[model samples]
Target: MRCLIAEDHLLSRRVLKELLSPDFDCDIAVNGREAIDSFVLAHEAKRPYDVILMDIMMPEIDGMEALKSVRSLEKKMQIPSHLAVKVIMITALGDPHTVIKSFNECEADSFIVKPLTRHKLATELRKLNVLK
Candidate 1:
């Protein structure tokens, strides 16, 4: 599967890529703006990403805003049935309010806390049916 990872922290991005390398084709974005641009480009290129891992805090644009934009585009474009994209919010903040907001407001497929263990991430992927 193809995945897009957006994080401002370089180390965190690297760690996520390393963890997902064995199971997915990964693309890295340094900030939310880059992430959105990359996502749009990939979609336009007819190679839409299967999943997106988004960090809430970022420069140029925040993950929540980026996700809203992505959803808007998806709605406006009336993306075909075959081009479904799932987005997962990944961040260090474990605030219940934020988690609730992410789910209610951003419509994320799932949320994951940082310092992610391989097992935890794998379990999430499996639950989402992105992994077998």
Candidate 2:
């Protein structure tokens, strides 16, 4: 499996990479723009990511805008809904409003509060069927 971890915080990026390393070949993006670029490049290379863990806050572009762009790109590519990359929005904000916005606005497949743990990730992966 391939995964993209998009976060600006260095420590958080390291932790997420470590957590996902066992199962996925990981790519790191420090900001939302980089994440979007990685997404496009991966597809061009015929190795599109199976999952993306996106942070809501970042430099340049915020995760929400990045997420929208990604979804739009997928649509333009004519990728079916089921074939689109599974997106899990990650953030420190656990508020219901933010969570609802993530899902309602960007079509995120899951949302994970910060201090991301193995269990939370695994559960979401299973639900998304990115993990069997």
Return the top candidate by lDDT.
Answer: 2
Candidate 1 whole-model C-alpha lDDT, 0 to 1: 0.87
RMSD of candidate 1 to the truth, in angstroms, is 1.4
Please report, in order, the local distance difference test score of every candidate based on alpha carbons. Answer: 0.87, 0.95
| Cα-lDDT of candidate 2 | 0.95
Name the regions of candidate 1 deviating beyond 4 angstroms.
Answer: 80-83
Q: Which whole-number lDDT from 0 to 100 does residue 48 have in model 2?
A: 97
For model 1, how does the per-residue alpha-carbon lDDT over 1-132 read when each residue is reduced to its tens digit?
Answer: 899999999888898899888888999998888988998999888888888989999999999888888887888879864465788898888899989988889878889998788887888888778888
The superposed Cα distance between candidate 2 and the true structure at residue 29, in angstroms, equals 0.5
**Residue pairs in clash, model 2:** none
Q: Write the per-residue lDDT of candidate 2 for residues 4-57, one digit (tens) a residue.
A: 999999999999999899999999999999999999999999999999999999
